[model samples]
Target: MTALLLALASSIAYGAADFLGGFAARGAHVLRVVMVAAPVSLAVELLLWPVIGASFDGGAVAWGAASGVASAAAFALLYKTLAIGPMSVLSPVTALVSAALPVAVGLASGDSLSALAVAGIVLALVAVVVVSGGDAGGVRPSREALVLAFGAGAAIALQLICLDQAPHGSGVAPLIVGRTVSSLIVLTAAFALGAARLGATRPDTRTAAGAGALDSLANFSFLIAARHGDLSIVAVITALYPAATVLLARVLLGERIGRVQLAGLGVAAVAVSLLALG
Candidate 1:
């Protein structure tokens, strides 16, 4: 029950982060946004280290660093895809792919679930797809954009799975290490893109920093929840983040909440309840 609640919280945080990050991505060099976001996220991880405990064990550090590499790739691919593709298609497809990989890994590793939990997972997935549906003004994404979305989702799944591979005793230390590595990687990428591209648009430093902070919070919740619960279940619940993202868009951006999206939100609530009971 506790894990379920934590997972739910993680979903909300992740959604909020996505909303901020997506908003910041617009009208800037993607690397500029990422560079600001990475360092801010690292700061958040550092702040949490004291409260969450930390140890620089070899296994933890290695796994965390590995995940950090994947994290860099995910951020690059996902943001670029969003810039090129329709949000309606990119978001749900990426979310489904990211969630599916973790669930597959969990089941293969012998994580078990009740039938009720399985049903909840199914509905949760449906909710992600349904909630992400919105008016895109008839703009279809290219095949290249679709491919990038898949790559981004795979990288995200890999990032989280590597974090989960860290030794439990290492606690938030892995997260700290991961954030540092990712920050450095993003910083380097920003530099590699050269100053002309970097200066192409005025950077939204404030929004990017908000994205960074929220992203770290979400990742922390996800790491803790996965440690305590079945990965398959946790991943599915976390994937429901799109619903939260949609809700946030409706409230913050005054985006229209379509009837299909509203129905998806209702289904998400019932799915979450069933998962909690299971």
Candidate 2:
């Protein structure tokens, strides 16, 4: 139950981080932002290593690296998708991909859900969509963004699977490896695309740095949750991140949350509570 709450909180933090990161990345050199943020995330995680006492295991390191690869791709694609699509559609769709995968994997692993729990999961999923507040207006989502979003979802799913299966003795080690590898990968990709040179003179760098720190903090919080809880539940709850992101948008970006989304969020909250109880 406690883990579920942590996961839920992690979701909110992650969503807000992502939105801010994406917003900050706009027209700026994606690679440069990644370069600065990834290393910083790694450093922060390293500082937490002593507190978490993450064990060093070959299997855990390997699995974490695998997850890192997926995470690297997920972030890049998610950013790319957000760049070209309506926030409402892209955010929800990408989040759905991230949320749905763990549940599917859990089912394949033979984890059974009660009827009530299933209903809750369904409601939570719907809430994620509503929270995205997708552009119902006349604006169309870019095809490229859609494609990238799909790819990001697939990658995130892969990351979740790897994280779930990773050795459990020390969550910190795996997380450190994951963040370090992910940072390197992002840096490499940025170099390859010459994206590091974009917006060289802009102040968005500060925004990206702040977002990265928050994102890294979210990752740390989630590691604590994931270590003690089922990945299926953790993933689903984390998927609810859009709710936080949407709320932030309302507060910071002056975005509006509709009645339907508010209802969806309420229903989803109840569902999450039920799921945690189960």
Candidate 3:
């Protein structure tokens, strides 16, 4: 369908995946979670192969590999950050950075942002901060946790920017290549960290698998959305993903959603609507 709808789908999927990934990481080692998640993502990509089709070229491979490396970093850092910090707050920090970087790059590369889209992006950035402030009365995050969150956001932005560079007809090949490369990276890291062993009885394995599948779906939606629309607009709209994560946290974990955060949700809706109209 439209890029706006597709981007929203991607955002929701990503938020859910982050929730699952964070929950799984708290009980098990981050490497173990990533190790399991990567392979599951690869399997999901393979399943999408026939449906989307693919054509690989040198440029696509190079760009996809770049995205894979960035994704490896993003997954490791983001999972660990979420494990240590409050997901409601920390996730929005990442989303803001991710959207900001892409918006800068896309604009520099002549993505053509209209006044309305720019206004929406400004509001989206505000929502990222306000939505993240939902648990303002809770414990503050450590400096290390904030660093990791920032790094993960940068990595995530790089991953998307690299993926957007792939040729349009290349279809899902870039994502397939990205997943394979990421799986290998995470696997290598897991083995080095002595977290590679996977027993069938591990309770978190199912959680990790679920996260991976959802992540793959999110990646697919984002890539399609970026291909069909302005990267700047798509990135900001997708950054509103914190709304989903925050709302999910309130429902599933009994987290308190303050008035400020509730207002942020309304702002997020207005931002997305402006982006769509723009």
Candidate 4:
């Protein structure tokens, strides 16, 4: 499939995972939710092993491990951020940063993008602010959340670029390696912070497991996109994920999208359409 299609699919899956993961984090500890999600994701990756035809190289494994660590950090911060802030604000902020860092890096390295694509990036940046809604007008972002979110974005941007740079026919293996390493990191953090105790009952466990599986699917699809397309464009397109979050909010949570946010989403759509055409 095309990069556009892959990005759209990845964004929707990731948005749903974030929405549910955020909801689940409200009652459960963020670490606990991540703990529940991690192992299931590992299993999913294992199941895909045969179909993926994965064979690991030492260098790929190293990069994948780094990516996994970054991803683990990202999720830990994201889930924790959701616990304290409104989704409308947290989602767009992290998403925008995630996209911007990679695009900036690409440009600095002399990666050329089309005029329309440049316009798309501008629109995406605007969408980030717009989707923040009135929340951006409120209290400043918490110091801790801001730090974690920035760290996560930087890690993810690097992961996208590095994963794209990894050798062909070895993409899937590195992704698997990344997830495994992420699980280990989350587990280690849980142990260090004493948050490793199982808290959820069967029902919550089931919900978290489902969330993990979805996340794994989303991650893997984006991994494919990174493997197949330009790192900058793929990251930018995938970062348009807030659109899915808004759509989900309307349907599941009955959350209203104000005029500003609605306009932002429309602009985002046009941007993605331009990106695809480019």
lDDT of all predictions:
0.82, 0.74, 0.87, 0.74
- Model 4: clashing residue pairs? none
Q: What would the per-residue lDDT of candidate 1 be over residues 234-254, giving only the tens digit for each residue? A: 988888877766666667667
Return the lDDT, model 2, position 177.
Answer: 90
Clashes of 2: 1
Q: What tens digits encode model 4's per-residue C-alpha lDDT throughout 86-119?
A: 6666677778888888787767767677887778
> Worst lDDT window (10 residues) for model 1?
131-140
Regions of candidate 2 where Cα sits further than 4 Å from its true position? 136-138, 195-203
Candidate 2 lDDT by residue in tens digits, 113-155: 6776677678788777766554534456777877887898788
- What's the CA RMSD of model 3 in angstroms? 2.0
Model 4: residues >4 Å from true position, as ranges?
134-148, 195-203
Residue range 66-99, candidate 3, lDDT tens digits: 9999999989999999888688889999999999
Q: TM-scores for all candidates? A: 0.94, 0.90, 0.95, 0.89
TM-score of 3: 0.95
Which residue pairs come into collision in candidate 1? none
Candidate 1 RMSD to the real structure: 1.7
Candidate achieving the largest lDDT: 3
- TM-score order, best first, reads 3, 1, 2, 4
| Model 4 per-residue lDDT at 103 | 81
Model 1 collision count: 0
